[model samples]
Target: MRNVGVREISRRTGFSPATVSNALNNKRGVNKDTAETIRRMAKELGYERSEHLDHIRFVLARKTGKILDEGTFHPGVIEGVERVAAQLKLQTTFTTIELSNREAAAKQAFEITHDMSNGIVLLGTEMAEEDYVLFRDPQAPLVVVDGWSDRLFFESVVTQNENSAFRAVTYLAEHGHRQIGYIAGDYRIKNFPLRERGYRRAMREAGLTIDSKWRVVVGTTVNTSYDAMKEWLSANPPLPTAFFVENDIMALGCMRAMTEQGIRIPEDVSVVGFDDLPYASVCNPPLTTARIPNREMGEIATHRLMDQIREPRDYTCVTHLSTTFVERQSVKFLQS
Candidate 1:
């Protein structure tokens, strides 16, 4: 007969308890050799395990239960979570929440912890302070991707928006472009604010003039951004040679607006965008944007949440991942 606890397995197999748990859970960060040895020992000891079903049963008994479904994914963020869940051989459940009312959304999120222990993933915008309060006791594991609350109330996996935006602007400046324009996202969102600050800081550092006409704050929707871009292009006679768009969605809108005006990308006006969504590569002239590690970010978020579930943390911790610049045909090199 074999012992089922992680400590017993660790002692029998000469592996750490963490390694034993990770191997049993099929999580990353454990050495293959160690995991294999632990598994072999379990098999030798006739330690019959009931597969993920047993774990699922345990999870279901928790007061905070969640279904990992399409409900959490918003637009570009869904594919990554779907891939991660598939890789984990987990069936996800989807639930929808309207962001306009934080209380309603929080209530829905709160109820998920009651009978589903699969954990919760927030794949859209960050949660509000009031919303975070709903999970103060955390009935189950919770992870936030591509966004963060005021504090690390829950585990988060997100790209470094501020640094990425800073680097994007620096790259443009290095390429000798000074007259830059910006189409920003909602100011209420923390990630967008960081990105805007990065863009402004980079511009000021380069000693370039940031024309008031060059900056526009568009709403969260792509259509909203498109209308704002069109208005700006129509109202201003002098358009900047280059533009920095907050996300690929907004960039698509700006692209349409610019094309209607008969401006060619990189030739008449250059553009850089964030998020590097799937369509970014297929754009007329592939967009030169910052690539986000969406899949890896999702996977990490899952693991982090699991960690919190296995061993509840005293406080929340934030993890910020970096982004890379993908040079495409969208931006033109302006030689001085």
Candidate 2:
């Protein structure tokens, strides 16, 4: 006899694995009618979740699919969580919720946390402050990773975005580059805006006048951003001597666009990127980027979650980690 589980229930009912998991776990978003049907099918199949091992559930919430779907940082985060949870002998469950539909998303969250007894780690990558408020119930221990809620501070571990972006841009200034540009991504996330803020602040402090047209906004994914950058280049907008992109993925896209257009990097225009992802080092000219400790962030977040579970606290806190600036051959140092 085989052990029937969420997958079995999903296959029988023609529902997604996430929906089945949520329905079985007493989570919300499934209409009452749908829930009842799923529960009946689960019961008929004699589905039973393994209870021998303690479980760490992760709810990856996103306002849109662009950042969560395309970015590579989440794997490191999940890996960190797995490493820490494994040491404690707890199994893990991963689920994703889209916040584009705010009402439905809130309903889904409330249903889970209201009756939830276990600790859940939320991947708060593309979540906003209002979006954060939806999961503010104290019924369960919640830890956040890769993002933070400032007003309603939660137990979160996130890399420093604003400060890192500021440093990256300032470094360009130190290399005698005054006409610095910015490659902004259209991912509606907390980190993206923070990084742009850092870039703008650095420019101001460096006494560099930013031409509005020099800042180009592109899509989230590599292909999309590449095309968008190419389109921006076609518009014949004034180009800056250096560019600071929001993340490494977008940085690569913009670089590819420039490279294809017969523009030489460093020699023609210096570039700096954030999130020093794997391919950053391997890319031609190698990227000068701010390295985010994604794996460490995951490990720290899990340890923090364990602490929160063991010793429930009166108030929750957000943990901010600093980023390391990785220098490479991408940026050109002009003579002062």
User: Which candidate should be chosen as best, given lDDT against the real structure?
Assistant: 2
Model 2 scores a C-alpha lDDT of 0.82
Model 1 residue 130 lDDT score: 56
> What are the candidates' C-alpha RMSDs?
11.2, 7.9
- TM-score list, all predictions: 0.73, 0.81
Error at 71, model 2, angstroms: 1.0
Error of 1 at 93 (Å): 1.8
Cα displacement (Å) at residue 125, model 2: 0.9
lDDT tens per residue, model 1, 1-336: 443555566788887655676686566887898788888887777755432211111111111111122112243345555566666676566665654566676566555543233566665354445555555444446677766667436677777888899999988888889899888765355567788888999999999888987887765455666787787778656878899987777788778878888888989889999877778899888999998877677667666655765675567778888988999999999885
Model 1's TM-score against the true structure? 0.73
Shift of residue 158 alpha carbon in model 1, Å: 1.4
